[model samples]
Target: MSTVNPNPSAAMLVIGDEILSGRTRDANMYYLAGELTKLGVDLKEVRVVSDDKNAIVSAVRALSTAYDHVFTSGGIGPTHDDITADCVAEAFGVSIDVRDDARVLLAAHYAARGAEFNAARMRMARIPDTATLIENPVSIAPGFTVQNVHVMAGVPNIFQAMVASVMPTLTGGSPLLSQTYRIDSPESTVAEPLGDLAARYPDLSMGSYPFTQDGAFGTNIVIRGVSGAQVEAAMIELANLFPRG
Candidate 1:
C-alpha cells in the first residue's frame, strides 16, 4: 500500500455583493484553485458571500480556522462598500489601523501618478495589526496576510500577481501528476473501464469530461496522482483498455 502524505489545504472566500448578485462573474476562484493546486495546497472549499460585515467576518473566521490558509478577494478597495480589511481584523480579534508601511506605499504610488493622496486613498492603508503586507505591483495598495488569511485585490491580474508573490513562501507537498486521453466513444461505453481503472489505481483520481460536438459524443478521461510513476502506469493501463482506432 502506498503511503499518503499529509497535504496543506486552503479555501477561497470571494466577498462581493456584485458576485452574489451575478453582476460580476468570478474569475479569482478558478485562478486561485489552479494556483493552489500547483503549490500542493488543495483548495477544498469556496464561498461567495455578500459584502455584509457580519457575513465577511464569520466566513473569514471559519475558513481561516478550518484550512491551512484562507484567501479573500474583493472588498479591499477605498470605496464605501470596501470593508474586507476591517472585517478580517475583527474576525481575528485584532485592531485595524493605518499600517505605516502600507501608507508609505500608497502615498508613493499616488504621488508618482500626480494623484491626490486624499482620505479615500488613505483608506487603503488600513490593515490588521498582526498582518504582513503582500505587494501589489499594479497598484501599491497592499494586500495583507494575517495568520493564515491573505486578503488580496478583486482585480484578477493584481490578485494573481499577489498569489504568485506569496506562493514561494508557503511549504508545499509533492506536485500533482496528471494525464489525459481523448476518446471518440461515448461516456456510457467508457464508464465501466474507467471505474475498473480507478479501482486498480486507488491512489489516483479519475474523471470523465464529456462533450457533444459535430453530432458525436466524446469524452476526455483524466487521471491525476501525486506520484508520477503511478500516474504514467495508470495511463498505460487505461490506454491498453481503450485503444483509439
Candidate 2:
C-alpha cells in the first residue's frame, strides 16, 4: 500500500510598496488561497511587505523554509522600482542577469510590435541563474522560480497567467473536500452543539459563518476534511443534532 499525504502546505508573499501603502488592493492573496485549496495545498501563511529588498529577501527565505511552496507576487516588471528578480536571487545566493534566452524572447516580442527593445524594457529579462522562467501568456515579460519559490507579476491578469503556467508542474494530493449546512438559527443557539461536533471529529475542520439577511440572523456551518467518509460522517452528526423538520 502506498501512503499518500493528504495535505500540502503553501505560503504567499505579496511584495510591493503600493499594496502596503494602500495604493493597490491585493487580489493575488485571495486568488491564490482559493486555488491552492482546490489543489489540496493548504495556504498557511501570507505576508504583505513593501518593495524594500531586505523585506522581500527575508520573507522569501522564511516562507521557503517553512512551506512546501512559496509564491511571490509583485515587483517583476520593467519599471525602475521592479526588483523582485534581484531580491529573489539574493535570497538564494544566486547572481541575476539578463540572460540571452530571456532577452531574445523579449526582443522578438517587441520587434513584432515594431517597438524598441530599450534598456528599460530589457530589465524584464533579468532572471536569476538558479531560476527557471515562468511563461506569461498575457505579456512577454517572464516570471521565474527558484527552488520552491515562484516569482510572479503584480498585475491581476499577468499574475493569473503565471499561476496557470506554474500549476501544471505541481503535484497535488487529495482535493480538499467540503460541505456546508445553513441553519436558520443564531450562532449563539447552536455554538455548543457545533463545538461538540468539532471535538468529536478531530480530522475534520468545522467552521461557523454568521450572516444577516432581511434582518434575520443565521449561521452557515462548513465541515471540511480530506476523506469523503469522514466529512459525511461528521455531516450526519451535524444534521442529527439540528434535526430538520
Candidate 3:
C-alpha cells in the first residue's frame, strides 16, 4: 500500500504579558489555525509566553526545532518590553540590529504620514542578520523570518496581514476535509458505536462534541481526513449509526 505523506506541522508562539495577565484575549492563534488549515499546514501546538527574555527565547528554540514551521505573534512592537526580535536572535545565535532596508521602509512610511521616524519607532526596524522580512501592508513596519521561526506583530490585523504575506511562500500538503453529523442523542448513547467506527477507520479522525440546546443534550460527530472520499464515507457511516431526530 502506498503511504500518504503527512501535512507540514506548525507551532505558534504568542508573546506578551498582557495575554497571560488576562488583560488581552488573543485572537491571533484562532485566526492562524484556520488559515493554516486552509493552506494544508497542520498547527500541532500553541504556546503563550510573557515578555520575559528567557521565556521567549526558550520557547522559540523549542518550537522551532520541534515543528516544520513556527509562527510568533506579539512583542515586535516599539516599546521597552517588546523584545521578541532580540530573543529570537539569541535563540538562533545571530546578531540583530536596525537594518538599513527596514529603516528606509519605516522612514518613507512615516514621512508620507507627516510623522517623525523617531528612535522609539526606529526600534521596529531592528532585524536579525541574514533574516528576510515579512511584508505588513496594514502597518508599514515589517516582520522578520529567521530560520524556521516567523515573527509578526501582536496587533490582530497586522498579524493577519503578515500571515497572508507568509502563507504563499510555504509548501503545503493535501487539504484536510471534514464533515459533521448532528445526532439528537447524548454522547454516552453514541459512545460505543462511535468508538467502533473510529477503530475501523484509523486513517481518519473522528470527534464527538456534546452540546445542550433548549435543555436537551446532543452530540455533533465530526469526521476529518486528507482524503475527501474517506471523510465522506466515515460521515455516512456516522449518520447511519446516529440519525437525527
Candidate 4:
C-alpha cells in the first residue's frame, strides 16, 4: 500500500555568481531533481542567479508563489558573498539576525572542534526570525525553511543532508514509474513509429534518446507515467510496433 497525492509541484533556485561565471559546476539542482522525483514532488523549473540581493529576492518571490515548494541551493555561508538568508527574509518582508537558537547550536559545535565562533563564522547563525532551522549533519552551519522556501547549502553533501532533513515533512504525491524499450534501428528510422505509439498513449510520456553503443547507433525509448499497468501495456504495444531483434 502507498500514499497517493495528485500534484505536488516545486521549483529550484541555484544562487551563486560562481556558477554563472563557470567557476563552479552545480550539482545540487541535479541531485535535488532526482531526490524530489522519488519523493513524488514534480520539479517544474530551475533558476540560476548571481549573488545579488535583488535577483535572489525576486527569484524567491516568484518561485515560492508559483509552486507548492521552493528549494534553493547556495549563498547561506559565513562569507560576505553569502546573501541567501537575508534575501529570503526580504522576500517575505521579515526581519533577520543572528538567532540565539542557531547560535547555540553553532557555538556548541565550534567549541567541540576547538574553533572560535568568530565574526564571519557566526554569520551561519543569522537566520530569519520566523524561519525553522534545517539540520546540517555535515557542517554545524544550519540551513532553514522560510515559509514555503527551503534554503540549503551549495556543497553537494550538506545540501543532500539538508534535503533529507526537509523531505520527511513534505507531502509527496504518487510515485512516478517508467518503462523502457530498445530499438535496434537508428533513431531516424524509429521516430515515426515512436510518435504514433506516443499518440496512442496520451496519458504517458514517451522519450527517444539516440545513443552510440560499441560504435553502433540506436535509440533507447522510455515511457513514463504514474500508472504501472498503463506503462506495461504501452511497452507491449511498443515492442509489437517495432519488433525487437
* Candidate 4 residue-wise lDDT, 145-218, digit = tens: 99999999999999999999999999998778877788878899989988888777777888899999998988
Candidate 3 per-residue lDDT, tens place, 9-40, comes to: 99999999899999999999999999998988
User: Per-residue lDDT for 113 in model 1?
Assistant: 89
The parts of candidate 1 lying over 4 Å away from their true place are 1-5
Higher-scoring candidate on lDDT, 2 or 3:
3
Supply the TM-score for candidate 1.
Answer: 0.96
lDDT of each: 0.90, 0.90, 0.92, 0.91
TM-score of each: 0.96, 0.95, 0.97, 0.95
**Model 2, span 1-245: residue lDDT tens:** 12234677899999899988888889999899888888988888999998898999999999999999999999998998998899999999999899888898999999999999999999999999968889998888999899999999999999999999999898887787899998888999989999878887887888899999999998999988888998899899899888775
Clash count list over all predictions:
0, 0, 0, 0
Residue 166, model 3: Cα distance from true site in angstroms: 0.3
Model 4 TM-score, all chains together:
0.95
Clashing pairs in 4: none
Question: Could you tell me the lDDT of residue 141 within candidate 4?
Answer: 92
Q: Write one digit per residue (lDDT tens) for candidate 1, span 8-75.
A: 88899999989888888999999998888887887889999999999999999999999999999998
